[model samples]
Target chain A: MPPRIAQIRLVSSHPQVYAPCDDSFALVDALLADRTKLLDHHPSICMEIGSGSGYVITSLALILGSESKNAHYFATDLNPHATEVTRQTLEAHGVHAELLTTNIASGLEKRLSGMVDLMVINPPYVPTPEDEVGSSGLSSAWAGGENGRSVIDKILPVADNLLSEKGWLYMLFLADNDPLQICLQMRDKGFGAKIIVQRSTEEETLHVIKFWRDPDIQIEGNEAVSGGKTAPQRGFDFLRSQISRLSFRETRQ
Target chain B: MRLLTHNMLASNIKGVTNGFPLRIEPEKIIEKPVDFNPDFLKNMFSKIDWKALADASKIMGYAELPDEVPEQTVVESDEFLRKFHHALLEVHLEEGALVCPETGRRFPVNKGIPNMLLHEDEV
Candidate 1:
C-alpha cells in the first residue's frame, strides 16, 4: 500500500537527531484534519521551521499531495544533522524541499518576509531549565525552558513576519505551554487561532492550533481602543471563548 | 541547493542590511530531474526575484533566463515557462559555498543542504 504520510523505515536517524514522536503525530493529524482547507488555501510558498525528521512537513506536502504542485517547500533546522536527515526523508517520499541549518530562520528572513503561505512547526515544548533551551543536538528538540515558551515566543514574531496576508500557520503546543495564552498572543498579532486537534498520551497532552490572519481582528496596540470597533471585539471574543473552553475541558481531565 | 532556493536566500548577520542574493561560489553543480508543472512555474514567476534568479542561473552556468524581469504575460508562454522551470528547479548545487555579500562569511553546502547558521560572533 502507498503511504499516506512518510514511511518510518525511510526516515533517516542519527544519535543526536530527534525522532518522530506523539507531538509529531498530533501535528500531522492536525494537518490531515484540515486537508481540504489546505487544498483550498492554495499556498504557493510553504515552509517548516525546526524540521527535525521532516515528518510533519513531508506529511503536509503529501496531504496536499500532487494537487499542490506550485507550492515550494522549505525546511530549516538549528542542528545541521537534522537538516541532512530531513533531506533524506524528503527524498524518500519523492518530495523536494530547500533545507537550511540555522537558528529558527535568521539569514533568510528578508527574502522570505511576508511570503510564506503555509507554515508548520512542531516546536520544542518540553519545559526544562533556561540553560537547556538552546543546547546543541537532541536536547534542542524538546527543551522549552520556563513554561516551554523560549523557542515558542521567538518563533511567533518570526512567523508573523513570514506569513502572507492570507497565510496559515499550524503549530503544536503542550498544555503546560498554555494554549489559551498562546492563542491570545496570536490574537494580539491579528491572527485567529483555533485548536484543530487535541491529543493526550501517557507523557503529555498536545494541542495542535491552526492560526490564520483574520482581517476582522485588530493588531494589538496598533489600533486605538474604540467602542465602535465591535467586529474586532467579537473576533477576540470568539478566540477567548474557544480557548477558555479548552482550558475548562483540560481541567476536567 | 537549486537556483530557486538561491533566489530566496539572504545573509542575516547582525547589523547587515540588504544581504540578499548571496554570491555563489559553485564547486559542484549538477542537474536533477524535477516533475514539470507549468502552472507551478507561472505562480512562482510572480513570487521569485527575477534579477537574483537570472544572476544565480548565469553563475551556475545556465544563461537561458532574461536579464530583466519579464512581464506577467511572458510567463504565460510555454517557452518562457520551460526556461523558468529549468533554472528554478533542474539545476542543483551538490557542493559549494554561499558567500554573504555584507560580511564575507562562507556558508558551506554539502549533499545539497545549505548551512545558514551564524557563528556566535556573527549572531
Candidate 2:
C-alpha cells in the first residue's frame, strides 16, 4: 500500500480556506518524524486544531496507519468553509475526522477534557494589527494579533486541560513567537517541552515543539515555579545547540 | 456529525453550567458505514458518558445501545459490539440542531459539520 496521506490533488479547497504551505508542511514533517513513537504510544483520541485544507491531520492519520484503528480523529476550525474543505479532504483520503466549526474546543471541552491522547496545532502565528485578528474572511487564518501570540496563548491552557495523563501535543511556532519563553511557560505548568523539528525558510523560520506532562515537575500548584527558570533555560540553550546542529546536517545533505 | 461527536459536545454558551449532551433535533438522520473496530469500542466504553450517548442515540433514531454500558462480558460479545459500533460511529446526524438542555440554545449541524460557534451575545 502506498503511504496513507491525502494527495494535494485530492485536497479540496475554498477561497476562504488556508491552503497547505511551508508551515503546514513543517508540521506534517514533525509528525512523520515521530511516527514510530506515536505508533508505540497508541493514542486513543487524536485531535487537530485549525485544520486548514486538512493536510496536516490527513498526514497524521496516514502516519498513524491502521495499527491505530482504535484511534478516533477530530479537528476544529473557526471558519465554516475550512471545516467543509477539511471534510472533503479527509474523505478524499478515505479517512474521516469529526470536524467541528467552532472557536477552538469551546463546545467540546468539558466532555473531552483529560481524554485527548494526541493533539496537533498549526495556529495563526502571524503578527498583525489587532483589528485583523478575527476578521471574517481568510485573514483570520494567519492574523495573530500582537507578536502572533493572541491565538497561541489562548490555545495553550486549553491544551493543558484537554490532554490526558499521557497526552502529547505538537505545535508550530515562528521564531518571533519567543519559543523559549513559551517552553518556560509550559514548564511552569508541569509539562516537559521539546523542539522536535525546526526548519528555516526564506520567508520565516518554523519550529514544531512537542509537549507532554512531566511527572517530575507535577508539584503542588502555585508553588512549583519559585526558581524554575534555570532548568528550562538550560533546556532552551541545549535546544539552540540542537537547532544549529540540525541545520548543519540539513545543509550537508 | 456522528453520535460520537454528539456525546462529547455541549452548549458551551458562557453562563450555561450544564449544557451537556445537547438535545438532538434531527432534521435528517443518515447512517454512514464505518469500519467497526471492537478494540476501539472497548477502549472508549469506560471513557464515554453512557447516559449521554444512550439518550443521544435514541434521539438520532438508533436505540440499539443499552441505557447503560453492559457488563464486560456483554460488551465483548459480537451482538453488543455491533450495536455499540452502529450507535457510536455509523449513525450520523446529517442535518440537525443540538440544543443546549439548560438554555435551549441550538447549535446547528449542516452538511455533517456542526456549527458550535457562539454568537457574541451568547459568548
Candidate 3:
C-alpha cells in the first residue's frame, strides 16, 4: 500500500486555527516546486496574506533566499496566534521574514501600496450564513460570507489599490466557486487574472483552487527576467504593451 | 485543498443548484517543492479528467500540453511523462478564493489553507 501522508502537528496557541489539510499541503507543495519559474523572475517584495502556521510562506522564503538571495517575504495573518506560529516556523527554518498581525488589507495598505512586487493571499472564500455566525472564531478565518465573495470583494479593491503596477497576485480557490466572476472583477479593475493550477480527486472530499493575477491586463510571453531588473516591473511593461495592442485591435475591429 | 477536491466540492444549499468547480480567490498562491513519485502519478491517471486539468492549467498560465492525449501506453514515454508530471504535480495556488457557481458563494484560502464553511442561511 502507498505510504499514508504523515500529518504534521500544527503548533498553535488557539487549537481553533486548523493546520493545512492534506489537499492544501499538496497544492502548496506543487506551487512552490518551481519557485523561480512561477515568479517569472526575481521579486523584490513578496507578501503572503493570512499566513497560517507559516508552513507555505516559510518554505517559500527559504527557497527564494536560496535561489534569488535578494527576495524577501512579508507574511501576515489576522490571528496573533497564527502569526506567532509562522514566526517560529520561519525562525526554525532559518529563513528571515517580517511577520505581522493585521486583518485583510488593514493598516499595512499604505506601507504596501504600489510597492509590492508579488502578493499572495488565501482568504476565506467559504460562504457562511448569518445563523452560522456562532462558528465565527475559526470560521471567520475562512468564511467568505453568503456569496463567498465577501472577502474577495473587499480584497480585490484593495489589491487593485495596493498592488504595484507590475506586481503579481497569486491566490487559491475552489472550482465549484465562481472564479470566473472573480476573474471578471480583476479584469474590470484592469488586472489580468488566470488559473495557474488545479487538482481533482476521485474522493468526494473538499477541493482547493488557486489563481494568479497581475495589473497589466495582458498575457505575457516568456520574457524571462535574468538580470537585476525586478520581474514585476518588466511584466508591467510587457502587459501594458499587450493591452495597448489589444486596444488597437479593438479599435480596428 | 487539492484541485481534485476543489473540483468535487459544491454548495448544496437549499435553493442553490449547479455547484461545481469551486472558484479560488486566493490571498496568496505559493508553490512548495514536493517529491515526485511516478508510480503515484500513474495510479492517478485513470481518475483525472484530463481536459479539465489541461484547461485549468492553461488558465493558470501553463500552456505546454498537447491537443490530444496519448494512449495509456504512452505513460512510459519520457517526454509524455515529463509533460504529465509538470501538469498534474508541479503547479500550486498559494492564495485565492473559491466561489460557488449556483449560489455565488466564496471560500477563502489563506497561507496554503482553504476554508469550506457554509453559513446558516446557506445550510
Candidate 4:
C-alpha cells in the first residue's frame, strides 16, 4: 500500500503566494529538507524569514527538542494571517516559536542585529517586469520582478546587516532569477556564496545556496562550529576588499 | 515572550533592513507549569538558539544550563534531560513587553498574550 497523504487545510489570505497543488504536503517536504540540514549543524540561533505556513520552524522546534543546545527558532512572515496560522500550528504540536508579522528586513535591526547565527530564506524569485506589480502582475511570493532580483536585492543588504560573524545564510532561488547575479551580490557583500543543492523540474528550477565565509577563514576540523569558524580578522579583511571593489564600481557608475 | 519567539521575529516595515532575532526587554515574566512532554522536548533540540535561551533563562532566574551542550552520552540522562525540558517548554511568558530592536516600538503582552498589534501610524 502507498503511504496515505494527509489533507490539511492551510488557510492563507494570499493563497496565490503558494503553489496551487498540495501546498501543505510541499511545505512538509520543505520542512523535512530544512530540518535535516539544520540538524546536521545544530546552530545556536536560527531564523526563518518568509515562513509561509510555519511548517519549517514548527517542525524544527518539534524535532530538535527544546533543550538540545538551548535552541530557539524564530519564524517570520509578512502576512499576519500566515503568522497566525504558524502560531496555531506550533501550539497544536506542543512546540514553541516566536511568530513575527512584518515585511522583510523590517524592524530586525533594532531587535536581532549581531545575534543570529543562521538565516534561511525562500523569497519571491520569479522575474517580473516593472509594469506588472499588482494582483494580475504575478504571485507576490514567487515573482522576483524584471531581472528577477527585486526581492533578492532587498534581502541581500539586510543579510549583510544582520548576519553575525561566522553565521550561515541559506536561500532557495529559481533558475530564471539569475543565481549568478545573486551569488555575485552576496560575494560583494563579503559573504562567500555557493550552490549547495539544486532540483530542476520541467517548468522550473530550484537551487539552494549557502552563503558564509571563505573556507580558508573557517576554523578547520571543528565539528562543533560546522567544519570551522571564520575568524573575525579575516572577515574584516574580506569586507574591506569588497568595500574597495564597491567604491571602484561607484567611481565608474 | 519566550526567547524562542524572539529569535525569529524581524522588523519588516519598508526601507528598514536587518530584521531578525527581535530583542526582548521583559517587564514581567511568569513561569507557568506546563505538562512536560519529553518527546516534544527531545524533538526540538536542533531549532533552538541555545545561548539566547540559556541567557534568558538565567535572567529569568533559572540557571541550570551547562557551559556547553553535553555529548550524546549525556542526552539520555534523566537529570540532564529534565533540566533541558523545564528551561525550554515549561517557562511561559505570561505578562511582559517586547520591543522591536530597530524601531523601538513596544508590543505589550497581557495575560500570556503578546499584543503585536500596530497602530495606523505604525502601519
Q: DockQ-based ranking, best first?
A: 2, 1, 4, 3
Predicted structure 1: lDDT: 0.87
Ten residues in a row with the worst lDDT in model 4 chain A? A2-11
Looking at model 2, give its docking quality level: high
Per-model C-alpha lDDT, please? 0.87, 0.87, 0.56, 0.59
- DockQ (C-alpha) of model 1? 0.81
Where is the poorest 10-residue window by lDDT in model 2 chain A? A218-227
lDDT (Cα, tens digit) per residue for candidate 4, span B1-123: 554454445544444454444455566676645555555456555545666667667765778977576677676678877887777766666666666667777766544445554565666
Least accurate 10 contiguous residues by lDDT in model 2 chain B:
B61-70
| Root-mean-square deviation of candidate 3 | 22.2
Docking class of 1: high
TM-score for each model: 0.94, 0.92, 0.51, 0.58
**Per-model chain A TM:** 0.92, 0.89, 0.71, 0.68
Better of 3 and 4 by lDDT: 4
DockQ of each: 0.81, 0.89, 0.02, 0.16
DockQ of 3: 0.02
Best by TM-score: 1
